[model samples]
Structures are given as structure tokens and as C-alpha cells.
Target: MEFKFSPLAYVPFVSVENMIKLVNSIGAETFMSELAVAIEEDFKRWELFDKTPRVASHSDVGVIELMPTSDGEMYGFKYVNGHPKNTKEGLQTVTAFGLLADVDSGYPKLLTEMTLLTALRTAAMSALVGRHLAPKGSKTMAMIGNGAQSEFQCLAFKAVCGIENVRLYDIDPAATAKCAANLKSAGVNVVSCKTAEEAMEGAEIITTCTADKQYATILTDNMVGDGVHINAIGGDCPGKTEVAEAVLRRSDIFVEYPPQTRIEGDIQQLPDDYPVTDLWQVMRGEAEGRTHDRQITFFDSVGFAVEDFSALKYVRAKIEGTEFFEHLDMLADPSDPRDLFGMLS
Candidate 1:
């Protein structure tokens, strides 16, 4: 008799180099578009997931977080750390990795680098939510923080929301310069602005993604107009926020998850009972978004675990029949089911 078995005993691992190659092979714009679809599909089925706020261990300097979720079949989680001052030492401010596992067998399926994937899925989620909440014909975007995630946001808006012009600004002029330089060939009109107000000129979408940990106000009440949409990305985690509390009071707020956003998003500055539309409800057509053209809309994004689950699942499907992943011998297999000691011996 011939014996044959599948490669189910091993897990697949996508390294940093392979993740980069996968993104490049898929094209950044197309990848963002597909990722948006993946995120939306999960959001539409939000009720099927087990959701919770990311577990975080905070310190005076930075934080480490674990975001986990499961759909009763596959489970995924990301291990991430954020240290804003690390860039001064020529290191990334944030780094991450994630894994997916089988729920029935409690076996690992995939392990992958999530730093770049996080940036991509975050931008994809912002643009996706913006598509539903932003005003009609929003072509220009003001990206206030020109850090590692700036360029990805610009491209994501272009791919997902049809944004044609991106205005860049940062406290560090070199950061703005780098963002602008990176967007030269991205097919969008890139403008480096001297101030946040200048960056907001003629821009219909305002994205405040600064990396400060304090309760600093990046977008004042006066800066936001009546019709524009605000993507508040920077103010994640406790004691961190980008938009002014006054601005929040006047806007139609939306969130990924209320429990998480209350603790980790810009809405943390608001009252615990403040009303907000869950983005999943809007995606599922159970709730409304952007009812009027003059109504201000805010997506208080805190990076949900479901988005990571969707991203991991998408990568898992995309890497099949491709050489982008390597088999990791992480699982133990014994020839005899009840002879674990004998197999080891």
C-alpha cells in the first residue's frame, strides 16, 4: 500500500522580504483595493466574530498590545509594540508580527510579519470607511502626519476613494519632504505644505495621524469645516488623541468598535456614553452614514482585530500556489497517537 499525506503538519511563514515581494507583485494600488474588499467582507459579517478590545500593557514611554479575534474556525492575533521615541535612535516607532491558528486542532496555520501588513490594512480600512462616510467628490486629502504610514494612506485613498491630490504636512520638514518625494511617481498631485492649515486648503478629506502619545490637539474645532470627513488615526491608546473635543461634539462619529474606541481611539476624549455609529452596522446596511452633504463625519479608527484577521486570511489565500511562504516545522507529529513518549524516545 502507498501512503501519502498533506503538508498539514507544518505551518506557513511569510517573512518580511516575502511580504514585500507579495505586495509588489500584487501592485500597491490593486493590493489596497483588494484589502479594502477583504476588510469590508469581514465587517459585513461582524456578528460572526468574537470581538474584544486589544489587551495592552502601557508604560511611560510606549506600549505593547495583543489583538486577538476568532470566527469560530480560524483564530488570529497580532503582537505589536509602539515606542514613539525609537525613531530618534534610527529605529521604527512601531513593529509587529502575527499568527493564525486552527480552532478545532489548536494548530498554527500561518505566521507572518505584520508591520507592513498593518500599515496596508490600516490605510485600507481608513479609505474604506471614508468611502462610506466622506462627502461626495472628495478628491483632495490633507495628511497631517508624514511618518512611516503617510505614503500608504495617500496611495490607499487614491486606490479606494479615487483621491487625486494629497497635501502633506509634518512638524519635521524632512518627514514631509520624504513623503512628498515618495509620492512623485504615485500618479497623485503631491503638495508639501508649511502648516496644517495650508495642507487643509482645497482638501475635502482631513487625516490627522500624528504619533504623539499625549492628549495633543492636532485638529482644532476651527480647522474642521461642516462637510469634510476626518480620519482620526493617531489618537489610539489611552491619553492619546488628535482632534479637539469640540470638533468631536459637532461631528457624526463612527467607530470600529465602541468598547475599543472608547479606550484607544480619539473618542476617548469624549464621554463614555457619547453616541457613535458602529462601522459594521453601516457596512451591513443596518445603520446610516453621512446622511447629509454638510454633515461632518468622523471615523475614530483604533485598528480592530477583525481587520487583522481579514488581512491574515487574505494573505493566506493569496500565497497559495506561490513561493512567497516557507514551511515552518513548528508542529509536533507522532506516528502513534498514544505513544508520545515513545515517539520522543
Candidate 2:
């Protein structure tokens, strides 16, 4: 008998263009909804996942992070950075890349540039929260911190939550104008506001994805009115939060994972006894989502590893036939499993 396996083959590396085409082909709406379901599924079986807090390196210039998660069968990781000053360097404030690997073989099955995918997934997660938490016939969304994430969030709300009119605001008027121009071209009804408060006027959903990377209070208590679903994405790290502490105290706080979020999400400012609900319970029908039409809902989105897992799965699914991956020699295989030193020799 003869055993045949390919070792010298190239790694399947996915480029940004390949990822865009794959996501577009699968239909952005379907992909987002499916990813939400995937996250929910992972959350339901929470005990199966080998999870850990993301490792982060912070500098005066910016912050870089590595998030890894595994299910004893498959492993995935993403490398992402946040540099608010990158625009001055003619680079995006956030640039990311990620990998999906097989746990048994410990080989990366697919590696992709997730700069665009991160924006997509971040927006998708926000919209999913609104879908489950916001009121029916929700049309308007107030988007604070209108930077790189502005357009992505707007498009997602429109596609997923049926939000047509987006109220946009940023400290930089140019940033607001740029986002408005891009979104208008995409058939989105964008209204640039002078202040974040004006944007919140009549908005059913409020999403904050600022890149300040500090304790910058973007959303004030007065701005957050009733019947609004607040998707807090910017305040995802320590010492960085968008909404005021009073906002979380008043609203029915919901988080992806409470344990990791108590340190990262906007809820960090609150005391230990501060009440909140985990989103998984709502998905499992174990807890209620929106109790009433007037209840203010807050989703403290800290960019969980599970959402990245869902996004990676979606990206790999679209790369079925096409060879969008680059084969890298990151692993070594030997005839015997126990001979780890032999491979090094």
C-alpha cells in the first residue's frame, strides 16, 4: 500500500479582493444573518470553546491585539490594530489579518487579510444587536464617531435592520462629510449633524465605533433617549468608553460575554453589582430581549472572539473552489507523531 499526501503545496492565502468577492457573492445580508446564527450557536455551547482574553500591546502610537479561540477541534486567531493617527501616515486607522487552522493537525487551513472583514464583522455584530433588541419599524440610526467604521455601520443598519436614514456626527466635519458622500453614493440617506446630540434626535438605534482609544465620552446621558438600542463598539478596551456610566445604569445593559466585557466594554465603569444580561441567554430564549417599547437597550460590543470565529467561517465557506490562499511552510510533518525533536533537527 502507498500513502500519498501533498506537503510541498502552497498555503491557501486569501487576499482582500478575494474576500470582497466571496462576501458579495454570498450576499452581505445573508452572510451577516448567518454569522449571527453561528455566534449564537457558539454561545449556546459555550463550554466547548477554549477562550481567553485577547493579548494586547499598547504604545504611544497605537494598539495591536491578538485574539485566539479554539473548540478542541478547530482554532482561529486574528491580528488587529488601532491607530487613530494612521490617516496622517496615509494608512487606515485599523488594519487587520487573521487565520483559521485545524486543531487536530495544527495547520492553518486559511489565512486572510481581515482589514475590510473586521469592519464588516464589527458592523454586522452591531446590526444583529439592533435586530434582536430594537423596536419594530426601526428606521433611523444615530452614528457617532463617523470615521472608518461609519460607512460600514450605516450600510449594515440599512441592509440588516431596515434602517434607511442615518444621522451622522464626528468631531471632524470633514470626516462626516466624507462618510456622507460615500453613503449617499451607496443609496443611503445620510444626514450630517453638527453634534452627536442632534444625530440622536428621532433615532431608533445608536451605534458608537469611535477610535479615540481613550476615556472619551462621546455619548452623553441626555442624548440617549428611550426606545433606543445603543451598540457600543468603540469602548471595547480598558480606559476607553463612549457612553457615560449613567447610560449603562439606566438602560438594560446587554453584552456578548459579560466576563471579558466587564474589563473592556462600557460596563467597566459600573460597579460589580450593576445588573446586565448576556446576549446568549436572549438567543436561547432563556431571558427576555426588549421588555417594552420604551425600554432603553445597550449592547456593549467589545468585539468578541466568537464573532471573529463566525466571520472566519463565512470567509472560508466562500473560498471553496477558488485558490485564494497562499501556502506557507509554518508547520512540519514527520512520519512519527512523538518525534518533535527530529523535525527541528
Q: Pick the candidate with the highest lDDT.
A: 1
lDDT of 2 by residue, 35-99 (tens): 66666677787777777888999998888999999878779999998887888889988889998
Q: How many angstroms is residue 278 displaced in model 1 relative to the true structure, after the best TM-score fit? A: 0.3
Any idea what lDDT model 1 has? 0.92
Q: Which ten-residue region of model 1 has the weakest summed lDDT?
A: 1-10
| lDDT, residue 204, candidate 2 | 91
lDDT of 2 at 149: 81
Model 1 off-target regions past 4 Å?
1-6
TM-score of each: 0.96, 0.89
In model 1, state the lDDT of residue 115: 98
Considering summed lDDT, which 10 consecutive residues are worst modelled in model 2?
Answer: 1-10
lDDT of each: 0.92, 0.82
